[model samples]
Target: MDKITIQNLEVYANHGVFPEETALGQKFLVCAELWTEIRTAGRTDDLEYSINYGTVCQEITRFMKEHTSRLIEAVAEQLAEYLLQTLPLLKGITLEIKKPWAPVGLPLDTVSVKIERCWHRAYVAFGSNMGDRRSHIDSGIQVLRDDPAIRVGSISDMIVTEPYGGVEQEDFLNGCLELETLLTPMELLAVLQKAEQKENRERLVHWGPRTLDMDLLFYDDEVLEEPELAVPHPEIPKRRFVLEPLSQIAPYKMHPVLKKRVKELLEELSDRE
Candidate 1:
């Protein structure tokens, strides 16, 4: 990915924990690296094809001056979100909020918080077996779409399927959704849980009937194994309910670990059944 680096842009802003810092104002520096495609701009020498660093610098200064936050962490996080939303061409942002001359009395260089935030593609599968199944699924989709950081892409048609895990339950309406997000895997999982809770999802039983069930099937071809999250979902190939809809939108999308396409997995699963 191409990048545009803007380093140590000076800004006079009122931001700090101490009242004196905000009242007296202080010098804060911001650095940003915008990830984008600048090849067209380079080839054509056209301003329209590229992001304007001059404009970004101005926006950063204005944003810093306008907002007063106690922590530079908040400042950096908000600034990253702001830039990502404001700059349509940017796929990601590496931001640093630098605070020099602290009141801590300790001799130090600079205190800053740096973060790398980027848009990541994720495939999520959802199902509902309880009341108003379609409504639950649709509401989940709407929640993701409405979030500022999430871009809901292809959504497969809802297909009714028998429940899994040997649990006797109502038929489930299953489907898959594609999303582009700036949230990390765990953060995205929290968001998904929020959507599920909104629909009154329950965990009374394993693979039990619920208002909504959502799983992260894949994330940017990433194979993640964490305490709370797993990418290239552990059961993507075994569950027809998941692969069927997933195949509809991302047939050729490969499983990073398995090295198999969605279509191929769906086919193999079908052959077994």
Candidate 2:
């Protein structure tokens, strides 16, 4: 990834903890490193192929002036998210906000807050075995699509499959989807869970019938094991319902732990049965 750097762009803003500090504005220095591919812009000498630093600088100035936050950390975080969401060309950013007029009694040159933020590719598997299965799945997808931090991409055709857990249940409508999101894994999980709850998903029985079931199958080839969530889904190779749809959309997606493509995992699962 190539970078476009903006150094020491100064702004006068009213962000501070103290009432006096907020009343009287202060000078701040902002620096940004925007990550994107610049080869095409360089080769064609086309500004269209590149992110305009001038426009970005103006946006930063406007954002800082318009929003009032008590902490520089909040400013940096909000600004980074705003730029990444609004700028189509930017893939990632490292932003630094320097506060030169800190009110601490001890003399210091400056206090700064810096952070890195970027989009992550993730796959979510969705299913429903209860009433209006397709509707449940479709509504769940819409919830993800409507989120500003998420960009829903290719969707696999929903398939009807028999329930997996040997518990008596209706066939499930299942599929997987690809998405690019700015939210962390935990945050993403919360969003999915909320969607499920909206559709009246129940956990009365393990692998029991439910109105919706959305699982985080992958997140940028990341392997995660937490108390509430697991990435790569832990059972991808064993669940044909998951792999079948996942393979349709992302056949070449590699598992971080197993180091195999989705199609390969699907094939292996098929062979086992």
Candidate 3:
């Protein structure tokens, strides 16, 4: 990835924990690294093909002057998110917000907060057993496509599968979807939950029938074992419904923990059955 670096662009703003700090402003410095592919811009000498550093700097100036937050941490966070969301050519950012006048008693020049933020690739499993199954799946895809930060990359053919948890319900229409997104694993989970809620999904019973079921299968090869969520989906290897569809889209995707390709796992499961 190519880079654009902006360092110590200074601004005076009211951001502090003390009341006096709010009444009387202080100096703030911002440094940012914008990441993207600049090949097209370099080849054509086209400003449109690249992120304009001048425009980005001015936008940072505007944001610093407009918003008043108590902490530089908050300022850095919101500003980073804002830039990433607004700039179309930008793929990632490393941002630092420095407060020169922070009331630290020590003889420090400045106190600052820095962070890195970027996009991620994720796989999602979609299923519906209720009314208009195909419609539900299609609508979910449309919703994802509508989101600016999420790009629907590829889709697998829908397959019919019986309920997995021994529940007395209708067969589900299942499939897999590939996405490129700027969302974290937890944020992606929230988005999936919201999409399922839109289709009136309910969580009354464990693996019970529902209108829609959207599960986060993998997130950039991340392996997480949180209480509410698990990446690599935990049971994906054992479930033919998930493996079959996921194999169609990402047969070569490697499991983070198992260290095996999806195709290998699918073959293993098939042999067992």
- Candidate lDDT scores, in order, read 0.91, 0.94, 0.90
lDDT of 3 by residue, 150-234 (tens): 8798899999999998889999999999998888888888888888888988899898888888999999978898998988798
Candidate 3 residue spans exceeding 4 A from truth: 138-151
Lowest summed lDDT over 10 consecutive residues: which window, candidate 2? Answer: 129-138
Off by over 4 Å in 1: 106-109
Q: Give the candidate number with the greatest lDDT.
A: 2
TM-scores of all candidate predictions against the true structure: 0.92, 0.98, 0.86
Order of models, best TM-score first: 2, 1, 3
Over 1-273, each residue of candidate 2 has an lDDT whose tens digit, in order, gives: 999999999999999999987888899999999999999999999999999999999999999999999999999999999999999999999999999889899999999999999999999999998888888988898899889999999999999999998999799999999999999999999999989999988789999999999999999978788999988798888999999999999999999999999999999988989
After superposition, the stretches of candidate 2 with alpha carbons farther than 4 Å from their true spots are none
Q: In candidate 2, which residue pairs clash?
A: none
Task: Give the clash total for candidate 2.
Answer: 0
Global CA lDDT computed for model 2: 0.94
Write down the RMSD of all candidates, one decimal each.
Answer: 1.8, 0.8, 2.6
